[model samples]
Target: MQIRLQKIIADSGLCSRRKAEELIESGKVKLNGKVVTRLGTKAEETDKIEVNGVLVTQPSKKITIALFKPEGYITSKSDPHHSQTIMDLLPKELSYLKPAGRLDKDSEGLLILSSDGELIQRLTHPSAGHTKTYMVRVKGFPKPQNLAPLSSGKLKLDGYLLNPMEFHILSVKDGKTWIRLRLTEGRNRQIRKVLDSLGYPVIYLKRTEIGKLQLGNMKKGEYKELSEKDISLCFKT
Candidate 1:
């Protein structure tokens, strides 16, 4: 069977179809010892395909793992700060897995780990508009007017304006407050910065859901392989 070169690259988990097309246009992709920049070029299973001089072959079964990351673990592959990484908690066989989206070192909860680069790109892309739900415990209760800025898109942090986000109050205690926030964008310490600017600093934050997948009862420091249904739902409309 033959398939478009971009599809082959995407199916191999090298990158998304759009990114594969960009790579093709950049003349980084080769077929049969020749640089092939034609977007519509097709390749068979036996065809010798290479990207950036590395042999490209169809990837094996895609693996998706849902991990409950604990606090104090970095979400990177290697950190010069000498901090422990999320990979340190995984089994030896999962060393190749990369985090789909990042959770700050002080925050914890559901982190999707996968070896499928295309799936990672799809899930993390802002255009995909996948909603990430977070349970935030703040230092103080904020007035309704304080949350107005979040929806108004006027909340600017570090010279970058934040996107409109949905905020829902979950509970309130003596001085502490619990809130559920949903956002389609992932910026560095975005939720925390927003709350801090509103005079209600975030004390603890944990991601509870992504798209239709919920963290459910997964314990801290534990992980589970995603089912076929989970994979389908991730990219489903």
Candidate 2:
């Protein structure tokens, strides 16, 4: 059977389909020792597939990982500015894996990385509404009325109206407020923007859970491979 080149690379645990497309576009992928930059190309099992001169073989098994990302690391492979990236947090053996979603360089918490692109696609899809929970510390405690917009399902930002999200107050200490929130969409800097718009101004933020996976006891910069059950959970949720 013939499969798309992107699917082949993704199943090989070398990268996600999106990243595979990028590699193809950038002329890093080759077929049968010849560079093939065309998207949607197909390959049979007997055909040779290589990326950057390395053969891409289908994974005999699939694996996913959860990493406790600390602040100050980019979630990318290479940055021209020489900033540290998430790929730096993993061992050399895990370099081919791609992140399922992103946590901005300045925000940190439970982040999922995987070789299974299908699972990554499903988990990262905005329509799935998979819960991504965060612990946010804001600089000042605001009156409850200011938070009504979030609970009311009508907060608009940048001309976009946001759906109601979980915005529970966990505690308020001194002059700051610690809150637990759950969001379905992965808007760019959404949590920070929403809180700042409310005049709270995020002082600290860390994601604790996504779907059934939790940051757990993993310390900063540490990661653990998911069990078979946990991998299944990614699809279920």
Candidate 3:
């Protein structure tokens, strides 16, 4: 069956479809020994494909894992400026897996990494509507009224309007506030910015759940390969 070249690259788990398209446009993708830079080029699965000089083929076994990412570790495969990355916490054999979504270095907890590009697309796509649950601590105690902007879902920061989210106070202690939030959007530094706008800067943040998948008993820096059932949990509302 003929399919778009970028789709083949994505299905092979080398990267996302959007990234694959960029690779193709940049003349980094070759089909059957010929460099093809056209965006809509089609090819059969049997056609040889090379991405950046490496052969692209679907893995015999798709792999996914749930990692309890710790603070201070970058969520990428590598970074020249950073000394630590989430990949350092995994075995070399699992290096092929890419993080489906991001958890900034300052934040910690459940993160999903997968060798299945389709799964990655499903988990990270904004339209998926997957909710991420976080436990947050902020400076100063916040009364219910202070959080009206968040509950109203009208909070805007960095020129982007945030989606509706579930927010509630867990406790107030030692001049700090602890809260739980469930968000459907994954804007960068969103929680921190939102709280900061309300005069409650975040002191700590940890994501404990993605959709129905929970961090459970996993300790920081630990990870477990996900089973089919466990993967299904990630899509559950």
| Model 1: per-residue Cα lDDT over 105-194, one tens digit each | 999998998877778888887788778889999988776777889888777879987788999988899799999998878899999988
Best by TM-score: 3
Stretches of candidate 1 off by over 4 Å are 1-4, 11-14, 31-34, 40-50, 54-58, 232-237
lDDT values of the candidates? 0.86, 0.84, 0.90
- Minimum summed lDDT over a 10-residue window in model 1 is located at 228-237
Model 2 segments beyond 4 Å from truth? Answer: 1-6, 9-46, 50-60, 234-237
User: Residue 73, candidate 2: how far off, in angstroms?
Assistant: 0.9
The C-alpha RMSD in Å for every predicted model, in order, reads: 2.8, 4.2, 3.2
Higher-scoring candidate on lDDT, 2 or 3:
3
In model 2, state the lDDT of residue 20: 94
For candidate 3, give the lDDT of residue 163: 87
Candidate 2 versus the native: TM-score?
0.80
Relative to the unseen true structure, what is the Cα RMSD of model 1? Answer: 2.8
